[model samples]
Target: MDWLRKLFSSPVPLNDSYHLSPSYKVFTSAFDQEILAKDLERSRKYAGEPTASADRTWRELQQFWATDLALLQAETTRLAGRLQPSLNLPKSSTLTLLIDHSGSMRGDKIQLAAFVAEVTVQLAIKLNLPFEVLGFTTVEWKGAPVRDLWSAQRALSNPGRLCALNHVVYSDFTDGDHPNSLRAMFLADLLKENVDGEAILWAVQRAKAWSAGPHMVLIISDGAPVDDATLFHNDPSYLWSHLHEVIDEFGIDPDVLLAGLGINYDVSSLYDTSDTITVFEDIHAKVLPLLENCLRKM
Candidate 1:
């Protein structure tokens, strides 16, 4: 774990291009498969069986044209006595994960954060729900502002894409050319800078524009908001005020749930100090229940 701190102590230049370095290959190969498998299994259980019901609309009747007329007519006549219309619940919630990769998250903290992210992503995929993963930290390195680590639009194209990097390691070394490689690097770099909670505002904007369904933002962090004065110099209450403004402007309420997963620290002070926050001294034991509880809330 101390090596992790030493590895990131010296800031490495950000690699904008998507490439998979040898270190990334080694890192992903070690952890991705097992994580993916476990997540997929859990997701399937949560997804349950797909249910089917009779379609009673003219739009559905169009399928009859594609069938053999004789067989279709016979089936239709046989089933004419028991035709009914039904609808299944649509997967309408979009899960947005906001992971804090600040300097404080080095070692086991970052690993657990990544693990939580993997599980959530797999569940979203199994439920056929759209999801986005984002990482936030300091605005700069080497005296210059850094760029966004990963965005929902850039890294995640679909649920299947999760399987593509299932064997890739999460690292910051720049050598290979792949989208997931960049993501791995981004997660690795979470340990490089201080926390900037204002980054959550950017995530909120993206969630508003990208998702049509109810949005759920789950933030995983180890500490309270920091770097506020650095990002917003005008108002001391900028973070809290801005959050309320966004909630009002977007009309996000019961439909939009904001939850936090605090590791080794209580982040409820950063939030409303309500049931919305869940603190864990360690994530290994309670991760599953934690995920399930959040899913239930949504």
Candidate 2:
């Protein structure tokens, strides 16, 4: 695997100020996640305003995933309250929808992602389980100030994750955000560079905090982590290794159920359990097995 080759290689050292950039050697702490979330709030000024958050743009968002969403809702009805069948899981089994807001997921992929989120939320509500919808993207397209700071430094060979990341919270179990409000996540301007490792780690922390027992986290992503600034300065596989490092760390946790639903892209190597689904019809069939597995695990 190309990732394996990049794994053993060393990152080109950089002489810049410390920020959210983290090396593969260190473990991500809860404090780190909090700091990053606060940083994203500070960086929101650099990103575009989310009209969907303030206005009723869900009408338009509904159209993108209408076909798939309708089919999924029907399926939910057919299954009734037996989504987990004989499992009889309690309300403690939380569900976290971790969405990738990278530019690569711009068109049909994003629509499919919305459909997936809707289905997950529907099932969670049906089973009376808690659920949350979260997304991740950079504040700036090119990673402005972070990149600028690196340039001001010696511009060394590698600078990890120079981008100013912006993590999103559309809905949470506290009921702070309504289901309709999740439409804000798929806004066009919100699509930017994605740091998969950072987003996944963030979601893992939140999901763990919400649930007392087993928690299922479905990560919707199209491809590997990609940030021009981060890649240009660091090793080609900097983010890739980071993602694996994070996944491998948490993948073994028996209390956390994790799976990746790729957008027409097979992510078996990236995740312990993953499946691909296109925007075309029959998405529900492909996704059902993963959801079932999560239930069984509980």
Query: Which sections of candidate 2 miss by over 4 Å?
Result: 1-22, 25-58, 61-68, 176-178
RMSD of each: 19.1, 7.8
In order of appearance, the predictions have TM-scores of: 0.48, 0.78
lDDT of 1 by residue, 4-23 (tens): 34333332332322221211
Scored against the true structure, residue 120 in model 2 reaches a CA lDDT of: 75
RMSD of 1: 19.1
What are the clash counts of all predictions, listed in order? Answer: 11, 1
Candidate 1 lands at a TM-score of: 0.48
Q: Write the per-residue lDDT of candidate 2 for residues 1-298, one digit (tens) a residue.
A: 3432333233334322221334642211111222232233334542345553413345665776577578778887666456646777766778788989899887778767766777777777776778888888876777664565555554645455677777877678886333665555445576888888878877777876776867788888988899887777678898898888777767777877778889978888977777888855646787766776766776
